[model samples]
Target chain A: MNFSSFPKESVKVEEVIDCIPVGVAVLDTNLRLQAMNRALEAMTGFSREEAIGIDCSHIIRNNLCTQKCPAKQVLENDRAVHLEGNIVNRERQKIPVMIHASVLKDDEGKPLGVIETIEDISLLRELDKKTRITHDFADLVGHSPKMQKLLEILPIISQTDSSVLITGETGTGKDLIASVIHRVSPRAQGPFVKINCGALPETLLESELFGHTRGAFTGAVRDKPGRFQLADGGTLYLTEIGDLPLTLQVKLLTFLDDKEIIPLGGTRSARADVRLIAATHRDLQAMVRQGNFREDLLFRLNVVRLEVPPLRERQGDIRLLMEYFLNKFNRQFQKKIKGFSPEAIEILRQYPYPGNVRELANMVEYATNVCHESIIKQEHLPDYLGGPWDEALRPEVRATVGEMGSYPGLEESIGKRVADNRLNWREMERRMISEALVKSRGNRTKAAKILGWGRSTLWRKMKQHNLV
Target chain B: MSEKLLITIWRDQVAPRFDLTSEVLVATVDSTGEPLHSKTVVLPTVSAEDLCHMILTEGINTVICGGIEEEYFEYLSWKKVKVIDSVIGPYLQALELARVGKLEPGAILREEASQG
Candidate 1:
């Protein structure tokens, strides 16, 4: 007859003898190893002949499961127990492991010691570490498919130390991208130094990029380390590369070309083992054509071009970024704000964000400070954002019946004729407002300044014109 | 229906003291005497066709402006709008003059001029 008809105890023995991933052991009250499977032999580097009838401690190398171990805790307490930590393999290398034990008894309900199983968890722990590192940059918020694509491409790009050129409108996260590149690169342990080419004059920019000796200039009181020197063996981000004055462009090109820098007022040239990353909002090719920029310099910087699309093109990202900044500012300012009201978010979505991510960040920070309730209301947003809230209150169809008939009684025929001759005031107003909004990025105060109106006057006009 | 013409006056040329050097005023008026519409654009310069397109978009058929560049005037005349030359006034005044029929087509002769 087939042994498949065998009783439960025999099956229990057979099942324990065949379980694959786990190393199972059966022991009596004396803690002697009774039975083990092929998996146990593979896990412990022992055959059945060597393992059977041996003390369980011989294989686990502990004196209590080897002294009062997890198995003992379960046996003494008559409950289950679990323990996790590193375990040494046959080669004596530490492998992460987990163990669980439960008391095993005969039909008479007497405690027959415990049965324990061990599982190697080294690969799981490694996967966990990898996941945590991946999650580290998730806090850098952006959700446009373009941004998502950029993020997707970042790791592949980070694997190599090729020179990268990041291009976008002002306030786009070019510097943040540079940081991400550095963090993911092999040089992550080294320093990351950043220099703004537009912030300094040409003479000073030269000294800042390449360190100077004592008395390099009239005011040089001592030797100073430039960004490249400070970022040796790491990454150096040169921002506004388009603005690097032509006189300094040659020096920068030479340094990037030769991987060396000649310090001001110094005869010796120093090797800089720095990875070059540059960012600019300006059109370098147009500048090259205009003869204001160096063509060689452009070629050197555009090795791996990363173009960050404008905010308007990526409207879906706005809400994600807004919520991220809201949470960030809530924690920073110790506020209890929940998030933007639907109306406020709608208004924000309609805005054509010329200032890009930086402007959105500033708005969130500003609103968080002034919000009283958990939910950020429209009024809490700066006037530029809330200004459009008033606009939303107006009828969605912009052309009103009143505006349609307001023309002086020239018959619809004569009115159309007169309207044709009349200054296209409405279109003109719309164009002016659009240009002003673009220049100011929805900031009514700045837009008002551009339009030659006081703050209060601008508010009144926004209300009057239904332009909020 | 009679056709209409469009005109655009350079903001700097219209208002000498304002910082609106980058703006252009667009107006749409019919050939005889009816007000159509007007708008402002922030552009470096305006050409005759730029003015004509602005008016055509609003269905206007007549054009008027102050200090027409010779090239633009010739192009505008060729495009069938009465090109008003040597006229100088405030933007609204020019429109009102166009409205009341005070401004008339003085000279429409063609002359060689720089396209720019």
Candidate 2:
């Protein structure tokens, strides 16, 4: 196996090395690049001529190069070494590579040099990322048992054209589930139209849902197709279904029974081939008992019901969702903020998100925007959560100003308030700002910074409080 | 009229991939295709989005690189920046041809001796 004893022209070693798909480099006993194949040259962005005689560490700038040189170890031990590491290529992109280094030996068992092979794993890494994203149903990422059960039934539900009623708390991804159902349904190719029943007044909402003809109202100068007609051959999602007026509920019931709709001021009824999906955050059964909602209409829309679990019920999803959103926002903002500090993560895990998944997403986005460091800290959280409150209770549900004096502890005072009671959240917020200002000696800028708020917000708060 | 040209570089050569290039050479040329000023910028990380941002913020009218992804190519094109990609050659030779407005997309300037 001595280089001097081997035939000089038996094989073109450089050509054979260049022919290999993976990158290959032959280093001298001193760990200098004796020769590099074309693949190695391409991977490192250094030509063979430029790479020759250069220090192997300088050419392959990897994390292990400064600490443990595999080539140096292979030369020392006269054995092969394999390592999984990453290299920052000439393009400045860090690529994961598998390095296999073996000592080249002479006939007398003397080490000549080290031959290293590098296999780029960029494609494998990309596939792994894709697999991670696809593990969830569509884009709704959750792996908790509750979420898993919901995901298991989604495909089956999407197979049908029946009307579906989705119930969840506000910001619990009801609208997202509706869209996911539409996307996975047979009518996926057709348009998916959505309208919020509570967003408009009764008359406007009626016209928006059901179409209008000329002279139907003073503002109606032309014919218009409503959501049902627009969603023909597709799916129609009605958000905030609890807000649909009792009178309009009859029209919806008729459409569900006969699949026909009569435009305002039009004599003839038209057929609409649209699947219906309704979502509501309210207790429709309670509304039914209170005579606020028609039971028959509820029955029609509730043919198939999907209940989305709140974030508190599925606490395991918090970290998963946090990481998902962290990666998402990192790509969006072009920032490389890696993860949250232990304290920040603990605070997030402990705090119950009343606003559900949407709130968590907003929290991540806010932290990403304000966090200049690589890791998000508790200080980067929203100002309300900066306090020592166990849960993020809505300000309106917390104890009133008068009751605040009764409880000695701040958390107990905040936690003592009852639900369904009316308290002006803005007034409470204003009072808190006033107290902070007084504590800071009326320095608005200092108070604003201490409150994790901008100077303009403090000024506006002061104006609203008549403390200007 | 003066125009700015950006070339993605790797070890004194045109990098084989645009998205992977960490360093770039930006040259300002006058109406006669003579370089007025030139400078090199090293990025902290490799990213097509960051490269697009640099192309826009630095007012680069033309870009020379290799193997650009379709998204970045279309984005740069939409931004009205002329992109000459898939170039294979030494950095100095690419600059010389670019200064004379003779560097074309997919141009190979490597010497015959180096072709294996």
Candidate 3:
């Protein structure tokens, strides 16, 4: 009789033995089992019955694996051992397994019993092993000189334990810089705390930064650790530092000056071993002069300043960022989009990113969801990102005045533009003066010569424009 | 490029409600029409005060949002971000009006509005 032609029960038992998901055992060194299929349960019919008390030799046709048996390698060596698919079943089929074995030894190190666990990874074996690359840091993609300079300095910045101030446009990844600093720092093992100064109200911001005790205010019921306290022994990052209220500026400065915090409604101060990193898109120096920000605090925070260039300024990074986000959203939304069309990429490159990196990511994610084809075309992006073909591509510059005519409407359109006009003029003159100044390298005479203006006229213009 | 014209536009509630705080946008031409830079700054209370301070201390020339209060106009005139008061409209239209030197003060400057 062919064992292959055995009844369904026998075949089921055989399948259980040969194809059991994980490792199984029927044993008796002296704890006798009448019969077993495999030294490692090669074929699985034994479900706590039929094989218990059966002799191993009669089933597997192999005696109790001794010191030399491959199965007992770990036990014999008295060391932890690992095994892969090596065990053979009664059906002579091989099955994948990982056996972690350690000796069950007596007090004198004499062997007593042996045990091992097994894990099957046949599914893993069948898989093609697709590579998974995360896009978390991919968000920080850039290869421009400015970005390269930043990347080079990031490790250096991380090495130092000084307070850092990051300045850039709104979406220029100032937070990314802080995070990268924390990740690359010696204190990487410590927690990284982030707070948006612009997001919270002044009253809540104080409590959020320094934490508060029970009965501190109407909302405080229990003692809570503020961001500074929670970030102790780590790094605390404050974004939009320019928006911080004047009242909190004093307290924040005190914390930075001395590594101590006074919690709301708490009597004494507590030490907080945290590194401070602050960022803002605004001109803090101007704020300092205006007395909105404390000059002393600005000095404390600007110990090491890192400037993140805006996306439009670093056009080289656009393609890379687009691809990174495309691949990410593809995997995320489980779409089969190939990539962006060349035209689409061109449009992205040419478009001045007013909103910067965060906006680019949002646009890419939106395009991925809306586009019908495998590749994203220019049309798939929002109208603002496209060219003149789309009406929304340009800023709302009305031909005639008083079109909207409402106070706020007029304010939004006209007010900003009038300011833009004067700024545009000043900017133009400033740029010309600077270019002339740079070429002349601080030579008032040569700058006058290059611009072809009379020496007195140049001097007067410099004084009037404050370019001197 | 004929030196790109830089203009500062202002509106009555522009500074307080949004970050119209010295946001400089470039004026360029595409196929459609006059295009301004996309970025804008909303002056914070402190920064607004700072802008006011610049006029006082540094004597920096300022382009006000359309129709600043009289005292602010007076204070700014005294301090000097050369308060260019004009009628509020679309940014380009406002700039054009300022460019031709046709922009005129729409209302008498008030001390109360300036204090706020």
**Highest lDDT model number:** 2
Q: What is the alpha-carbon lDDT for the whole of candidate 3? A: 0.62
Of candidates 3 and 1, the better by lDDT: 1
Candidate 1 CAPRI classification by DockQ: incorrect
Per-prediction fnat: 0.00, 0.00, 0.00
Candidate 2 chain A lDDT trough over 10 residues, lowest sum: A397-406
Per-residue alpha-carbon lDDT of model 1 for A334-400, expressed as tens digits?
8888777888888778865546677778778878988889888778877745553222221111222
Task: List, residue by residue over A68-146, the lDDT tens digit for candidate 2.
Answer: 7799889777789999877766555568798999987766777777899998988996786556435435478888898
Q: What local lDDT score does residue A399 receive in model 1, on the 0 to 100 scale?
A: 22
lDDT winner between 2 and 3, please give it: 2
Estimate the overall C-alpha local distance difference test score of candidate 2. 0.80
Ranking by lDDT: 2, 1, 3
Candidate 3 chain A, run of 10 with poorest lDDT: A128-137
Q: 1 or 2: which has the higher lDDT? A: 2
Which candidate wins on TM-score? 2
Question: Chain B alone, model 3: TM-score?
Answer: 0.46
Candidate lDDT values, in order: 0.66, 0.80, 0.62
lDDT of 3 by residue, A1-468 (tens): 112222345335434544545554423234233222343453432333434443222222221222134335654466766654433232323334455555444456665444444555555644512111122334468899999998877778888999999998767789877987887676776899999999999989999999999999997999999999899779999999999999899999888877789999999898888999999988899898898898999999989999988776795798888888888899999999998888888888776555678777888998999997988998899875653422332233322223223224443545555566668888888788889989999888999899998889888888878876
